[model samples]
Target: MNAIIVTGGDIDISLLENYIAENKEDIIISVDAAITKLEKINLIPHIMVGDFDTLSDDDRLKKYAELDVEIVKHDPVKDFSDSELAVDRAVKVGIKNIAVFGALGKRFDHAFANILILQKYKKLGVDITIYDKYNKIYVKSNHFILERGKLWGKYISFFSLEEKNFMEKLEGVKYPIENRIIDNIATPSLYISNEIKGDKLKATFSGDLLVVESRD
Candidate 1:
């Protein structure tokens, strides 16, 4: 089953509500203060994970406790972030497809760390996408196809996550490339702001690709 993790970051309430409504059968997970947001919308999560350092309301926690929500508490001195912990819980439960909301916000470090989680768990066969109001971010290797109207945003960008250069081919896009070498440091803006030309866009690459679908 698909899993959705809500972390303590800036989130668009309307987007969150609509996403949850669309995927009602997916498991819902909350991280720390994110539970407060869910409670505001009258939605209860199946799993709550955090160190409780950012969660100040004892009464609310007790209320959910009474509701039988599975709360996984961690020490304040842990190595990983609450978002990572929530992902771990989902992975441990055999949830392969994870969508993380409230992951991008004021805290740049936390946002970057959350993006790294996509690459880390991707190696273990877990597909994780970080979503915000204006962007959808994920890491992919080999090949991927983006259907024209099914994309999250109008502009699509690609970045190489590896140190070495890799050959990439792009088709069905405004700026098509044929077996072009991509090095993150050398050609940082080579594949940015590409729009789909027709019904779909296809990309095949030899290295890890950080794909960002964004809109203004």
Candidate 2:
């Protein structure tokens, strides 16, 4: 099944609407404080997972109660972030494809932590896409097919998620390269800002890579 986890972040409402429209079978999971956003949008989450710190008072929890949504409350001292907790719940419920919204925002550390959350999802054999107003981020360890018009953003780039050196191949991009070994010590900015040129683009890499499709 498909699922979506709405976290506490600055998200584009329009993009969120598109995500909801496209994934009709999505199980919505709202993190603390993000419940307000879902309420504003007139959408109730299927499950709510968080410490409820942003709920302000018990009255806020009442709204979720009225909706009969499943609530998984946690302690503020927990190790996993609220977003991670929600993702874990989704996985436990057998969600295969998950789109994460409100993950990119003002807090740089939180945003980066949310990006790293995808690693756990990858290990769990679940596909997750972290989306925002400008970019879509995911970890790719194998070959992937990219279509020019099917991308979320204009510029496609790859970054190393690990320190290991590996060979990579690129095709159908503005700058195509073959069997190039990426050095961990060298400048990785070389793989940045590459544009897709043909109808389809293919990427094959030996090690872990973070793929970001972004706009200007």
Candidate 3:
């Protein structure tokens, strides 16, 4: 099954609506305060996971309980973040594809940590993509083909997620590169802000790479 984990962060209502419209059959997991956002959209979460720090409304909690939503409450001092727990629940339930929403917000550290959660599930072959108002982020370790008009934004940036050196190549972009070695330990910003130029954008890279497709 596929899943959409909503975290407590800056959420784009339009993006959230689009995701819901597209992934209607997928399971929805609400992480803490994200439930409030879902409530506004008239979306009843399939599973609720968090410490209840942001879910302080007693009536809402009672309503959720009456609706039989699977609630997995955690401690305030737990090691893993609420977002991580939510994604882990999805993975455990045999979800192969996961799309995270409302992950970026005022809390920069939480936002960054939520973005890096992609790496945890990447090794398990779970295709995870984080969708915010201005960006779609995921980790890539092999060949990728991105069509020009289908991209969410005009700019695509690649960064190494490892400490080793590897080769990378980009084609069908404004700034194309041959077989360039990317040394993560030394120079990490070698591949940045490459715009799609033609019909398709092709990328082949060794080692772990984080791809960020962004807009203005």
Candidate 4:
């Protein structure tokens, strides 16, 4: 699958290494301190974008430049955050699917902001995900399937984002909602820790649905 990885410095190197190992052919985009994770793992990224304020090591930055990795330098005084810069870089690269790491869990504000940023990519037809040590968070359009995870430790949760009809159909979960309208800011109290019993768990909603997979 064609994928882009945007790094944000809050990475567990081992976890990042393991996840990207399967998607080796996917483009690697490192942002800010996230570049250091690549340097630590002795891997070169395809694109490194962010303000270099966090990375004080001149030698580390120079090595990637010498290795010919595409670097997009931005001003620290910009309106957008560094992670957004990396996300933009990924879009410019024209990848339809993106998996972002270290974008969550480093800071609460960043994770919340990342959720809001998800809206921008939806219009572009890009499927983006924000993943961390214990969670892989994403959004599903009106219609999608929820099959059992290939790996263990993935518990799913659903939320409605700025829409009234968030959970139109939820099957195989302990609590199932069929054709319901939920508010955008509604608390995701009902959809949590649900397991898929059948071959596929199908959901069709009228508006945006936020899906969170928390691994145990």
The lDDT leader among the candidates is: 1
Clashing pairs in 4: 9-34, 162-184, 164-182, 165-181, 168-179
Q: Write the per-residue lDDT of candidate 4 for residues 1-216, one digit (tens) a residue.
A: 455565563677788888789788898888877776777878788888888788766787788889998878888899988887777777776777888888776578877888877767876788888777787778777888766654234577777676555466777665677867666456547566776666667777776777787877
Higher-lDDT candidate among 2 and 3?
3
lDDT values for all models: 0.90, 0.85, 0.86, 0.74
TM-scores of all candidate predictions against the true structure: 0.97, 0.95, 0.94, 0.90
Greater-TM-score candidate between 1 and 3:
1
Clashes of each: 0, 0, 0, 5
| Candidate 3, number of clashes | 0
lDDT of each residue in 75-107, candidate 3, tens digit only: 989999999999999998799899999888899
Would you list the clashing residue pairs of candidate 1?
none
lDDT of 3 at 177: 79
Best by TM-score: 1
Off by over 4 Å in 2: none
In candidate 4, which residue ranges exceed 4 Å CA deviation? 151-154, 184-188
List model 1 lDDT by residue over 70-160, tens digit each.
9888999999999999999999989999999999999999998998889899999999999889999999888988998988889999887
